[model samples]
Target: MASGGSKSVASILLALNLVLYLVITVIASWAVNHGVDRSRETASRLPIPARIFPIYFPIGNNMATGFFIIFSLIAGVVGATTSLTGLHNLSQWNAPNLNAAAVSSFTTWALTVLAMGFACKEIELGWTDSNLRTLEIFTIIVTATQMLCTGVIHVGVSEAPSITY
Candidate 1:
């Protein structure tokens, strides 16, 4: 089993990530739905260059916002799943479980980073709605949190005493 402190740290981080990811999921879904609902009206106002794209987001830098939304949604789902697996691993506290959790957490962190890149681009392009801005902030925060969670899990796995049959 891992040290008590490491385990607790991992648990807290996993819980935090779960909540953040869920929020990201909800916000991103809302953004997508909002865009779809207003697509016809939005499309009419868009420039010819923007009209070429299949999925049109009416706010922000259209292309960056669209990519940001898509990636944020993907990262949110994956991060939530990773958090669940991490919770299971915390209960088990064994080599195999830790390894699995570590891998998932790392993957989630990478996805979050990808989403954060889009968020940065969206921010640079400017003209985002409140919801979109919220999603961007959450994505940026999740990226950091996910990295911390991954690091904590990795440290726990390394610090855990080896067991032999």
Candidate 2:
């Protein structure tokens, strides 16, 4: 509802989110393309141990894992725009009615996911000893910011596409 009536804000937010997500994805992809990336090499060397979803979610969830989740995060946001939940408040779906449930639920769910994904930090080691954990948290924050920015930018706008971001 926020930026739906105005395209400028929505586009700007989307572009920004995409850029941030791309930075992380590109770095991870490069690491996969080369032997320089540690996760890829480890996964390839010991494929058996990488089957667990959570453990394997980040590095190779699909985009190549160490960064694959970033792509999924993108997909999740983009998908929400087109999902049934998003359409409930759109002019295309409800010519005039604006049920609060859809908006509330969608907003709540989106924010919750973004928060969880953004602030995720499963490991608790000495701050100085957990470089990768720190990096993961950093990525989560970047991804979360992108998602949150994209999702909330148009919350009060009218008739604009409800982006999952």
Candidate 3:
């Protein structure tokens, strides 16, 4: 594909990913807050094993829910950051900028995939709220979008004419 084509594709994907990541961040933050509050209320009444674990989520898919939420939060933040970097790179439209954006986008995609794995686990465990289910769907979608963004950036970088010192 032409550099212009790649840039447009990356821009669109980055925008989409940014919005999805922000949504994930907000929902995950709410879930974390809810989980903490519930855990605090039941802390004293909880059993030894439950009390021992620092991150205990009383709702959703039990243990897997906690992992999923944490990872989703991480991925959301990283993905947002990656999107910002990608936007900057798009504005510049150079090999170095594209490379940097590609690296960050790849990292964010990996984190998103990790979160998606936990999402799958949470799904398998069952019993999740509507917000969590929404989060899972977004995470899965972002994983693919992020990968596409990274791939497009890399292709753009590679296709650019080499600079001689």
lDDT of each: 0.88, 0.41, 0.87
lDDT of 2 by residue, 103-161 (tens): 43345346435434433433321232233343355456555554554354334344533
lDDT of 3: 0.87
The best-first sequence of candidates by lDDT reads: 1, 3, 2
Ten-residue segment with the worst summed lDDT in candidate 2? 121-130
Stretches off by above 4 angstroms in model 3 are none
Model 1, span 1-165: residue lDDT tens: 447889999999999999999999999998888888877887887789777787678766558888889889999999998898899988888777888899999999999999999999988887788889999999999899889989999998887656788
TM-score of 2: 0.39
Evaluated at residue 69, the lDDT of candidate 2 is 41
**What's each prediction's clash count?**
0, 16, 0
- Stretches off by above 4 angstroms in model 2 are 1-6, 33-119, 122-138, 153-165
- Highest lDDT among the candidates is held by which one? 1
Per-model TM-score, in order, reads: 0.92, 0.39, 0.94
Mind sharing the TM-score for model 1? Answer: 0.92
